[model samples]
Target: MSAAGSGPEDLARGVLEGGARSIGRAISEVERDSVTVPAILRRVFPRTGRARIIGITGPPGAGKSTLVQRLAQAYRRAGRRVGIVAVDPSSPFTGGAILGDRIRMSEIYTDPGVFIRSMATRGALGGLARATSDAVDVLDAAGFDPILIETVGVGQDEVDIVRAADTIAVVLVPGLGDDIQAIKAGILEIADVFVVNKAEREGADRAVAELSMMLDLAGHPEWRPPIVKTSAPSGSGVPEAVAALEAHGAHLAASGEGRRRRSLRARSRLLALLETRFRRAIEARAPEPDGLEQAVAAVAERREDPYSAAARLFEELVPPPREAAERRSG
Candidate 1:
């Protein structure tokens, strides 16, 4: 399909037909927040909500990429089509990804059953790219099952980004800095499955034990997260990890958390879209370039407060109901 004249309907049809080029274009629109995004997403929304979104996150050296590779292979072996979204850090100068995970996934890079896309975070914090969800939606609409999202590995505090996933696996390794204490507070709650990768390395058993203790201390969870040990390099324990993820998926579906999770994700996306729209509207209402500069200078010098300035701008975009009625009548 030609990007120039292709409307949302054409693009939606192309995506549902599982054409890689069409899906790539769809995700590009999502990342760039193009004018056609709303229409494209609206048309494709019904085709989503079927793929299992599983997130793998951890520190830089925890081997997340390798583990994701093995997991994708395992899924493909079972005759399931896999899609991977690897969120990588963007270069400061060019705003492109450095060390994209696709480089590391050379083995499966050519697999027809696997679709892999590396997304530059573009300064979005908390591990995930801002448009990662939209990209996942495109993959879902393309009929890929079990989409895997590998985060930028921002460690503990950034784990919240994985809340978008139906099942989150937090990868850990032995010999990392205070591994248990550092992650217990922030990652423990959101993690659905714990993976101790590089299991043959020193202190692997100890790491597993510490994670177990922390889970115990976190109190009784209705569905306790299972810890699976993996040596991704040798491809050991990968099946167990995959099984654990599947089991968690089943638990979520049976207990109705699946619906709740989707609802929460949708709510977040809606709020983000609203915030973006409002910001654009406010920018469009700016008086003049010089006037806008003066307004910023005033705020910086404390001559005007930010809240008042924001309220004033909002009033211009959306007048009060009574004021609007009076203007209409007059």
Candidate 2:
């Protein structure tokens, strides 16, 4: 963490110099929505867009964490600095991560080449923390190449990972029952690579065959996602998975899809930031009775419809276009 007196410029300078503590502090500020966030982002924005962001998502109990750890190890072997952001389900009582993914990745904690941060979903939808993308940018600016994001894997909504990662790998385990049902949960469309982990298990081949059949049915003409089998504990098949991811990266570049994805990412970030700022401004400027609070109470008491209450609140907080124009002219 950065010192209490350190300014945003100093913190940003430390982040650019690859100081792990500074990186941690910067992400903490982002998560807190600190007053200095805009300043820090301004300084670090130019240093971002250099890292490869990979999103690993899948059904629960599919060993996604192990795969992420293995992938980090493989990237480390290649002498690449790796950054990991693991989004865990929030604890209802504390609003903190329930089971930190870093525990499963204990081996890599000591490696100076690897930086890992575990984030709580904090009730955000889409299996990702709201601040996860910002955290990735912090790591990227700190010189980590190949940043890995592991989502909470809440089935259907996990597709949100596509907006955050350059390439997404959806992991599945054999013997999980009804593989088709899992695919139908919306992960099938977002996967750049399908990984059948626990390959030594009885139904590994069956899982692969089922995925292949589905891909055939879907017909991806531009680039078909490849399936790779791996047993992460023993590190078997990890190299092949890495190769498949690298191949996808190459295809994305050669086919111009990479630029398209980056554009989408930028758009998503802008919209998210705008939404956040609007909500904050509304709350901060609400009247003493708090327009939002009164609206909620009214709707709860059945005195007013939610739609009407929301419109009233918006009108109260925001001037109508004609009023604004007249005021400016006056």
Candidate 3:
């Protein structure tokens, strides 16, 4: 389809046709503008509720990709359509498998019921791939039963998929000194499930204990998100891990938590889109050259207070909250 005729509905139709190339092109546009993603999402919204969105994240060398591959296999074995987003290091995005080797997931790739895509944080993209979330929706709309998002075990900043996913599995391994400390805030605080992958490793037990204790202290209301230990390579503990994940999914679906969780995700996504749009509008209207550098220089020279300078910029961009009411009344 030409650019002029390609609207979100067209993309949605393309996605439903199982045309991976069309889906990839659709995601590129969504990534460029967060708002554009929501437009496609709106068209595919109802169709999306059918898939189970699973996010896997952890620190480097934690075996997240391998575990995701295994998990995809397990789901496919049970006669389900599975979609996977393999997120890898930025370097691999330039050449090698940032998303890991297609070979790792090669088993399920030819299953006819499984679909996979690779995404990475590259170049000026410091965060997760902007298309990651959009691609998930596309897969969801395409009738994939479970969409597995496997992100490289980076720190908090890269774990943004936790926000976009329906259920999150924070994968970890033993022998890492500050594993818990590294994942404390944005990532750990939001985990719906935890996987201690490479469970055969020496300190794997210790790592599981530490994480379990933290989860107990936090006190989730209906269910304590289970911690599953797994040796993804050897296939040990894979069954229990799969069972626990499945049970957690059922619980969410039955207890109305799924609806609540999705509502929260949608709200977060909408606000993020709004902020991105507002920033772009402000930047386009009042372009600031070397804006951050100018602010730093002003502070270093004591010509302006940093806090006041930030406030000045806010005033330049955002009108008083009542501007909306005025627009409505006008």
Candidate 4:
């Protein structure tokens, strides 16, 4: 733990120097929701913003893991250090990460320049573990150039997790009828690049055509998501997909969208932190044990509605001005 004699400051320094053990431990701290995460991030924040965060998401059976493996290899070959956070579905019994994705990428498991971590979604609806952004920060501080986040393959809600990425690639495959239409209104809106994986399949061309039509109907903006066809096993179109990713990065830099995206990420992180702190504070000041049980019982019996109970709790925590004034006068 970072909280040992050397402390979070030491851990942060190790992370900045790209110590592999330190990076792994730091990410573990974040995953465990340690109290030291904020302190560690404070020390390493300056070293961040250097890594380009890329998010990969899609429906199940989209071959996302295979595509991610190929992309990581391409980046490594190009001399870029890659950090991969593979968000996997949680094991129902243990609440731990399922290692299927990691197992699929076994070939690159030992690569020195590539670091991969499999995280369980832990019931988060966004297809990402709650600690995902924090894990990315740890990787960034460790000087990973291109950080990749692979979401659990939940179609519509995948966008929430990938919003943290500088460029989001939505992976889709052929022969999945109506999949495009199902996700078009949500994840499609967040994509900077659309990937047609298993493009050699029968309906691959039709899938591409449908995506093109959707992009057209969405109204041509200054930055249109480019669709890249990829057949991962054969390494087909992998380079082109990488090129599209790089192009989007270039576009973000040239158009100043990168700064805007960073700002949004910062704002969202701050709000989440604030919400967490506020909840903790309220919990610390929770009603007396018996009172709490009574309240719960009331709600369970439907004698007191949850909404009204919540309002009462809020008022008790932060008294209304009128009540405070009356108390002062009295």
Per-candidate RMSD, Å = 4.1, 4.1, 4.2, 4.7
Which window of ten consecutive residues has the lowest lDDT sum in model 3?
A: 90-99
All candidates: TM-score:
0.86, 0.85, 0.79, 0.84
> How much lDDT does each candidate structure score?
0.78, 0.81, 0.72, 0.79
Model 3, span 1-330: residue lDDT tens: 642246776776777776665566666665565445667777776777788888888776677767777887888888888888766654232244434455555667677677776664554333344467677878888778788887765555466665567788888787665757865865787677888888888988888888888878888878887888899877777888878778888888899988898897778666766776776665565437636557668889999998987777677667787996898799
TM-score for candidate 3, please give it.
0.79
- lDDT score for candidate 1 against the true structure: 0.78
Model 4 bad stretches (over 4 Å): 1-6, 90-107, 123-129, 153-157, 287-308, 318-330
Candidate 1 residues 1-330, lDDT tens each? 543337777887788888887887888777776788888888888999999999998776678878888899999999999998877452221123324654555657788788888775554553244478888888999999999988744554256456668999989898764755666666666788989998999988888888788778877457888999999877899999999999999998998988888898789767877887877776676666534566678799999998886776667678899999999999
Q: What TM-score, to 2 decimals, does candidate 1 have? A: 0.86
> What clash count does candidate 3 reach?
2
Off by over 4 Å in 3: 1-9, 32-39, 90-104, 123-130, 216-221, 287-330
lDDT of 2 at 223: 91
Backbone clashes, each candidate: 0, 0, 2, 0
Tell me the deviation in Å of residue 242 in model 4. Answer: 1.0
